[model samples]
Target: MDLVIKNGTIITATDTYKADIAVEDGKIIMIGKNITQTEGAKLVDASGKYVLPGAIDAHTHLEMPFGGTTSADSYEAGTRAAACGGVTTVFDFVIQRKGQGLIEAVEGRRTICDPQACVDYSFHTAITDLTPEILEEMKESVEYGVPSFKLFMVYKKEGLMVDDGVLAKALEKSKDIGALIAVHAENPDLIDMRIEKFLSEGKTSAWYHYLSRPEFVEAEANKRAIHWAKAFDAPLYIVHLANKEGLEEVTKARNEGYEIYAETCPQYLHFTNEVYKREDGRNFVCSPPIKGKESQEALWKGILNGSIQTVATDHCPFQSYEKDWGKDDFTKIPNGCMGIENLYPYMLSEANKGRISFNKVVEVCSTNVAKIFGCAPQKGTIAAGSDADIVIYDPNKKFVVSKENMHSDVDHTIWEGIELKGYPVMTFSRGKLVYKDGQFLGTPGHGQFIKCKGRK
Candidate 1:
């Protein structure tokens, strides 16, 4: 045995109990009561603490380029923040440009991430152009352990949007290749008309970003994507589902036996479009902009009733300075914010209250995310033979959200001043203590790539 964690209430996506967990060669070797410690083995007494599998953030665009500026968090800084926040694995997007081959897009991203990640990571190839060559290359990515693909229904101007025919072909490719297709559902034509109208009427404020792409935009696209995926018999995963309309679409599809899933983010759940009224509201600008408070309640209903399966941070980071670009023109603001470092604490804090259960949090934050991305049983479990990626959470640990106390290179946090009752006191990734008590103990490149299995 290399290490032993004793007297901790082990939590799984479906179960919880006090037990002793043993680790060897970066895997959980034994989990039982009163296991005798071997000589030279490090012992950690997790009394009164909750031991859970480290979170797996399924959505992040680390160091991605958008709006003429790169996201502030590089792979090193992003993964380091992920570790500090008790996330053991993250799936960052690899976008294929118009002239790039799938291999070039994927390998290029890997070249940067492989040497910089501080926690295990994987890639989700985003399809901007579904050419025959690119369609064929989808199989190569699946063979290389990336079994999921991302498609955007919006972003037409940025050259990232694909029309319905392209989406049909992409879904066919995913179905044939045994891969999952995740869509960012927002009606682009509607948004274009709305944005033009708003600008023509001189309604160009930070808040107009939300007004231009309202919940109905997302809902309409969600239904359309579901229809397309269903017609092609391809499984669908909707990312960043914000309002009731999308959740209703996902729920209906799921009930009709269509293979479908959806996820919501904390920004949508906690902060509403009202944030745009603030002076610094430009910082909250993101695609499929945050909706009103009713939408937040709708997302919670989806979670409570099983319509929504995960709560991943669409952690596309940008600093306030970059956000300032859109000061006079809301559309110029880089569309993303920092959240990889807050994924675990924000959810755990919600669980600490009566809003959600610890078990449900484990499901959304860890277990189901791994399953959805096909990294499961390896990255999301704490049982024997699973990777020793675990977080010891102190239920009583108190803290408030602040950039000064965070590990991300960014200078601000959207969650500033929000107090919390629980925190990840110790995080172990593959048997290594990577983070402890607000300090990062691991170096960049310590993390490696996880080979995800095909979904659907």
Candidate 2:
């Protein structure tokens, strides 16, 4: 099949130019001035639009079970929503629950996603259990194309947090295999102690939860993780860093030439700890919960200064009814929020407000993510020979985020009622017109499993 997207201002992290992109057999065959179209080719009139590489959401949780309830969006619904929002790729986590082997956990998550996703996907194995056998399997798993591993520093008793020794050993192993170690940075002992104190004092609301695990807990953990990474000379990825202090730690590490990179989510950039005090504050409940206004502004500065490499949604979806699951006792609340479909729009809105540049938007949302994840130049830019994953975005369009317009199966939107300018009007995945103008045309199983190149 041949497709032509013409007359758009094509934006990449490096350059903006007027060009026509021609795709044939799911690859960019031509990209230049006034590319002539063949007979029977599909033509996309992209005049007055911005054509850029499709966004890549590096963090997402689909159908993940946490705190007694599963996230509402299955891989099918979540990736469909991602595609509709112009994200052509996702690097989702494969959970390693307690007592499950690392390989089994990887396979289980793969089973859930293999036949369902509508966009290309890759996996980052979450190592919640540290056993000799499981540790031994890490090299093999990395060999099998799952090159990055994540360990959490929270949920002490659950199948989430890893003790310091386990984390150290995992980092040592990852270094040997050249795999990246991603961390969910929070001081679990501090958080648990505070939570116990709060519960004993009869303070058990969503607001109390935010107070229990304060920004200091995250900041302390961030510094500690960086220390460990430096000690072992291990490459590290700090996921969903929510505060300024944490970004400062990341900046310090980068300045010292440490192989450390961090990602921040939209929740931290836009929402403050004040959300917890709202009547529906449980909707924003997440681990290392959003902090005060000062932190929010600092996080925006982190994005502008390049201390934070990428902006991901950390898209975790659950129903509003599940908000009760976190009621009365914040400890029972699941830790996540949904925003995969809103990522680019939110960043674009920031650009429209002059908070950031359009080139920076492409860098954070697409290019930088691809570079950190080892898919750079191939999936993150609209250059010749790259995958023809492109989006035609209308910068003047404005819309409010509501559950009624969302493509995910979740019953609530964390960003509901927020007005935003700019949206993707058309999305192409590897030369195929998968989403356009309120419709999805991709088939199931069209998404291929991408084998990521590990840390070099």
Candidate 3:
């Protein structure tokens, strides 16, 4: 045995049981009751603690470029933060900016991250154009193991927003290639109209950003995406779903047997649109900005009831100097916030407050993401023969979130000054200790690029 975690309550989506997990050569060799400790194995006393599979942040923007600036975290920094927070894997989006070939954008992003990441990583191509050439490249990219694609309905003038016909063509192509399509579901026309009206009225506050992109915008786009998915018989994933109405669309589509999946980010679950009312509200500006308090409650209900399938960080980081870039106009500001390191701590605080069960946290943050992104049974669960990616959690541990403790290059935390309970004490990637007790043990370029199985 290389390493053994003993005397912990192993929690999964389906079971909570006591067991000792043995790791040998980066694979889970055995998990059972009262396993004898091997002579030379490294041992961890997980007494009175919980062991869960490492979380997989399925949606994150590392080294992402937006609003004339790039996100502060490079692949190495972002993944390092992820490891410290107990996330062992990440599926970051490779942006295909307008006019660029999809393959070229993917390649460029790969070059930036290939030698930088510290944990297992994969990519989902953001499809900003659906030209015949780009769509053809989509099929080829799928063969290289990037099986998922994303389109934005809100970045109409800047990114991919197909009319009914283009959506049909893209979905049809995806069907033939066994790929999944994810959409940033916001109605751009409506948002632009409202934004123009607000600006004309001199209402350029950060709070107005939420008012301009209302829940109905997301709901309307979600319903349309669902219909398109059904029409083309293609599986679809809706990213960063913000409100109750959008969840209704996903639930209704699933009830009608459409292969539709939706993910909501941590900001939506914990913060409200009122966060934008602060003097420093610009720090919280993200696309589909945090909605009303009622919407936050509804999203939690959706998570508990199964309407929302995954909980991801949507970890887009920007520097504090850039946070005030929208002072003159909210629309001019970049839309994103930092959360790669806060995902687990924030979720655990929710659990401590009785908002969600501990097991449900693992389900949304770990299990469902793995299953949805085609890495299940290997990356998401603590079963035999699976990769030994694991985390030891201290539920009673408490810490205050501050910039000094964060691994991101960004200057401030969105949840700064917030107290948090329960954090990862140790993190392991494939039987190797990557993070432990506030120290990062992994080396640069140690993480391997994983080719995701195409969505079936």
Between candidates 1 and 3, the lDDT winner: 1
**Model 2 steric clash total:** 0
Q: State the RMSD for candidate 1.
A: 1.0
Q: Across residues 1-456, which tens digit of lDDT does each residue of candidate 2 receive? A: 389999999999889899999998877878898889899999998999999899999999888877788888889899999988889999898888778877677777777788998998888889887889888888777777788899988876775888889889998988888788999999888888899899999998899989988889999999999999999989999999998888898999999998899999888888899999998888899877999998899888888898989999889877888877878888877878999999988887888778898889999999998888777677899887889999999988888888888788988898989998888888898888889876888876778787777775
Give the whole-model CA lDDT for all candidates, comma-separated.
Answer: 0.91, 0.87, 0.86
Per-residue lDDT tens digits for candidate 1, residues 1-456, read 999999999999899899999999999999999988999989999999999999999999899999898989999999999999999999999998997887788889889999999999998989898888888988888888988889989899899999999899999878888999999999999999998998888887799999888989888999999999999988999999988877888899899998899998988888999999899999899877889988889899888888899999999878898899889888788999788989889899899988988999999989998888888788898989999999999999999989999998888988899888899999999999999999999999989999999864
lDDT of 3 by residue, 103-192 (tens): 678778888788998989999988766777888988788888888998777677654565766777778888898888898888888999
* Model 2 Cα shift for residue 127 (angstroms): 0.9
Better of 1 and 3 by TM-score: 1
Question: Could you tell which candidate, 1 or 2, scores higher by TM-score?
Answer: 1
lDDT of 3 at 211: 91
> Which stretches in model 2 have alpha-carbon errors above 4 Å?
98-101
Using lDDT as the yardstick, the better of models 2 and 3 is 2
For each of the candidates, the C-alpha root-mean-square deviation to the true structure, in angstroms, is 1.0, 1.4, 1.5
